[model samples]
Target: MQYLHALETAIIYIEAHLDEDIGLEDVARETGYSYYHMTRLFKSAVGETVGSYINKRRLSNAAKELLYTENRIIDIAIYNGYESSEAFSRAFKDIYRISPLEYRKNKHDFFIGSKKGLNIDMLKHITNSITLEPTIANFKETKIVGIRGEVALKGNGLSCLWEQFHRIYAAIPHTVPNRRDFCVCETNQTTYKKNGDAIYSEMIGTEVDSFEEMPDFVVNKTVKPGKYAVFTHMGSLANLEKTYDYIWGTWSLSTKEELDNREDFELYTEQFYSMDNPDNRIKIYIPVC
Candidate 1:
């Protein structure tokens, strides 16, 4: 969404309210965008939801108090908006994986998630690389067989997995001739590292006509029929992150379409032969409601 004005206003509003309880409606009122629009713009541009960002800010502050000052943990908890020390400890453990008492005793110097303030450079990098509007189309059900493993959101270590997959792909019986191979990612919404890195279960494989004669090491999957927003990722795979930021962070925000909870995948065809070629391109399918 090119609503840069509204997005800018939102960052200002959020920074001002970091010390207190912040809400989407409050930010919307101050920024002049509707609740729905403000929510989308803030998350898309900033890469996080308003509530989660606010929580991180407060927790970061509370952590400082635990390390430097001799303030009581209960007092620090209340200052950060927790009603009780137990509640605060629970939240603290969820992020830091340590109790407040243990954290204070150890006196660990720490930093919460780094996403804060408006990233002007990152936002400006979304050049005319990808299509502004995605092609909305219905996808047919396809059967897949591949090796699966957990991969980090950043620096997706999928090359080795894909290489191993190729060894088995040719031997699989009754393979689809014209269909494109898929790199499927199943994201975990509730789990994240302390530094905010996401871990997703990814599978890289090609379409198969039947489950019979499938290798024991590979698991089979069926992508259900649904509508998706298909965007083209132009250039080498190195810049796919920028294209995705624009798709999930910008285009999806500006559009009135809603996304559904379904498997999203990358389509690999002959264009992918040159993995690092500047002219290479691929289509990414995101399930939408």
Candidate 2:
């Protein structure tokens, strides 16, 4: 578990410093793991070399800037840590199959995939099967007390954090009623890096009336009152990523609603029997304006 936590911390460090000149040694030192051990763990867990991940993320962000911003290609390249425009263009064309200028001219389709391109057909199928109509609910400000950590948005860090939280939840004091667990993703500040990799502060805890008497190890947080687009995720927790992909990639993009800078969270109700259960249902709430 400690190794897993260290790996996640390394991922966050990499994401937070992608625009800077970073390397494996920097990540290893940040996470307090040896260079060889960190490399092996990252490869095993993330299924990609650290250098490859960084390159792909840089290219992905550069593509986004090309489509969204009017910055010159050379400037965008430099901003993304490329030494030269020629090198940046070469890498961009390698992934996008088009020159930066050409992509900007015909910026109709946005590529949001990894080195392995996204399967649009599969995404459509998943979106079609799930009903994502959100219910508008006004929630009062709520307090949560639990252990918190930084997790990489792309890898298994979030899931692993949840597992660790569950293991130690019994030790925490002042938990609330109905066995309702809150998996909160803090997005109000510095949630994502330029490379589209996120360093989210996640907490797995229960609601509390106040934080006055919280234990020393537990962290206290507040969820502000707002209108939320509440969507239900009915399936195993493992497949929750598919639902998220659809929501962020397809639905949110198309919707007219503007998302607010608040913490999005998962409400694990009584129906959530266990992580592996097929029938476990969780409610996802996204703060929206």
Candidate 3:
């Protein structure tokens, strides 16, 4: 938990220096943590080393700059903390799979007035209080229309998934539940990326009983059944992410029951009518053995 506080402080430093040179020592100093401990904490809480995380982020931002600004590639590279154009190009290609010149030519990963940026500001102050209860349950196999994509803990991965859900749902006609949305994290065992990345968050809606054709989206064939460690998260969806860290980072470390090898899910039992209400709760079901 203290490490979590340190992480929050480190993220604030990262956000403050996104456009400047930010090294591990600087982050450690700013966060009041030793460099070794800071690296350990960041890796434990966020999955990647601090250097790798900062490099990837700078490269991601550089990609956006390539698309948004007509600034020279060298300038963009230097602005994002890269030593030289060659170094920046190598790093950019590693993350985005394209060079700055080609990226601009294709107009890829850019938009007009798109503040499509990721902020690590909230990582440090994540409110994480969760109670996990063990129970055995059976869930009826349900079919849903949803968009599926790999998501990272960093960036607007969850927000983008919801955006896709709305876009796909707008094209379909059904009596979908509006307030209680279903977000199922696909099993990490079968589909997780090599870096122990977070599972995909699918924005889903139950298929109408009489819908003649399934929409362009794939039918998510998943069954929610088994023993689980259920945790209820209350408050805004934006803040629900910290709840996940608690489940994975804190609860799992302190619990007797091991996390089950089944798909975990979030049930939005109630909508956030007001952002200030403390009684609103969302249930998180983690399969446990």
lDDT of 1 by residue, 157-225 (tens): 666677777787766677787757888877633244544455668888788889897767888888778
RMSD of each: 8.4, 15.0, 10.6
Give TM-scores for every candidate, taking all chains together and pairing residue i with residue i.
Answer: 0.59, 0.58, 0.50
What lDDT would each prediction earn against the true structure?
A: 0.72, 0.71, 0.62
Question: Candidate order by lDDT, highest to lowest?
Answer: 1, 2, 3
Model 3, 1-289: lDDT tens per residue? 5666677677777867877877999999998889888888877665556776677667767766776679999999999898899998887775555788998787644211111222343443233333433354545454555667766655567767766776676665553555345677765432333232435445455444335566655455444556767777766666666666545543454457765667777765445443346556667777776
- Indicate which candidate wins on lDDT: 1
lDDT of 2 by residue, 8-41 (tens): 6776777788799998888889988898988897
Least well predicted 10-residue stretch by lDDT in candidate 2: 109-118
Task: Go through the candidates in order and give the clash count of each.
Answer: 1, 0, 2
Q: Given candidate 2, what's the lDDT at residue 175?
A: 66
Rank order (by TM-score, best first):
1, 2, 3
What's model 2's lDDT at 253? 40
21 in model 3: Cα distance from truth in Å? Answer: 4.4
